[model samples]
Target: MNAWSGRQAPSLEDFEEMALAALEGLPAPFRDLAREVTCVVADFAEDEVLEEMQMDSPFELMGLFVGIGMAHDGAAPVTGQMPNQVFLYRRPILDYWAENEDTLSDVITHVLIHEIGHHFGFSDDDMEAIEADAETEH
Candidate 1:
């Protein structure tokens, strides 16, 4: 078995690294779009985040984005779209890792890319194609 197979809590910095690395693995176009976007990690979803996202519960949101989309072309302040940010809800991630066989880093990466995919307005089909291409490259 691989050395790091089990679920363990990731330090804040560790989570950031894994998330960033995952972003780096995306296609150049997608990676460029992700630039200027900040990534944050939290133990749980905040009340405001929950309300803003309209999440029924903390568990419902494993990640989130709040920012102006590239489509807007910076015509207005983010009051309507907000700054681009990717939020990784740490606790729920750990919970999923514990129950599943995947490593924590992989989970973080998936969430990171998935949220960034939201920024591009990529459909599920687009994401699947991207993911397939990424798998082939890796």
Candidate 2:
């Protein structure tokens, strides 16, 4: 039998698990700050979200960070404010994974860390360094 036989795409729950694992795998300092951020996985970007982002396709967005970042208001908690959240679009991620050289776990980790970077108001370069640190620790 072919090595690919009987294989199937990961389900929503599986994606969630992978996302959480990625969060847990971050370096200590990043992981500590990221612990407060919630991770949510969905099949695709919602219509309203796509409209708001001026995106024509759901696949255009793989993940999003929702809530005030540390750079804004020191990330203080205000009354009635929603907790910080990182949303992972599973279908788009899987689609990207299908076309990329990276493994599914690596893709998921990248997206998760990118969103977490938004939560901490870190730049792309900072996130890249964090990812590199994580890889070295593993």
Candidate 3:
């Protein structure tokens, strides 16, 4: 049975509010980009995501990006190919925060920024630099 089968969870509105605050705490350009993005929370990773991402453990990943970046040809839609979205995995994120030294909000912000990096077609190196910059600014 799933761990969350009967547990109470924060409401969708509450989760969104928290995510928005996390995004708002990011650095300049990223903060601006995140304002135009939508964040969605899921209880766990989808079966397909587990298989495709080759996740041996359910708690390995905390979030995902599912839409085209602004660097892509056309605008990304919030649900379809045109909209951009960030998917937060609740169980995994919570597990990570509980296991690690980072704060929940910090972890959420990292995941949020990482996913948004995809939206802007940022390369891994680019993301590293951006993260470093954010860290210094913080």
Candidate 4:
């Protein structure tokens, strides 16, 4: 059994490393798309984002996708515009890990892919299909 070492939740830097590894594990095409998107690891969802999502608590949001999707904006931002960003709430992800059976790496990958789907303007079914393809590659 794993001993409890009284370690705190993963830090932002740790989350960043995990997110990078998750991205690298994805298929080439998907990873290419994700390359343009920045990944941010924060302790919790911002208040404004929570209100926008209608979430009652910070823990309710594991991650978020922000920016104009390729389907809507021709796959590139106009002058002076920001590119896509995926915000992974570290605290929420840690909380979820504690309650779920999946490994931390798997959970991070799931969240990253789901958020990237939003960046691509993909439906849930599309995301599922992409994930399926990724699994088959391994």
Sort by TM-score, best first: what order? 2, 4, 1, 3
On TM-score, the candidate that comes out on top is: 2
Report the C-alpha lDDT of model 3 over 24-119, residue by residue, as the tens digit.
Answer: 667898777666677889878898999999999878888998866778744444455445678998878878887999877777777887888988
After best superposition, candidate 1 residue 27: deviation in angstroms? 2.3
Candidate 3 regions off by >4 Å? Answer: 1-13, 74-82, 132-138
Q: What are the lDDT figures for the candidates, one per model? A: 0.76, 0.90, 0.77, 0.86
Cα TM-score per model: 0.77, 0.95, 0.74, 0.91
Instruction: Write candidate 1's Cα lDDT for 87-106 as tens digits.
Output: 99888888888899977766
Best by lDDT: 2
- Evaluate candidate 2 by giving its C-alpha RMSD to the native, one decimal: 1.1
Which of candidates 2 and 3 reaches a greater lDDT? 2
**What would the per-residue lDDT of candidate 4 be over residues 34-71, giving only the tens digit for each residue?**
78899888999889999998999999999998888787
Q: Give the RMSD in angstroms, all C-alphas superposed, for model 4.
A: 1.8
What's the true lDDT of residue 115 in model 3? 89
Give the alpha carbon lDDT tens digit for every residue of 64-129 in model 2.
Answer: 999988878575677898998999999999999999999898898899889989988899999999
Regarding TM-score, does 1 or 2 come out ahead? Answer: 2
> How does residue 129 of candidate 2 score in lDDT?
97
TM-score quality measure for candidate 4: 0.91
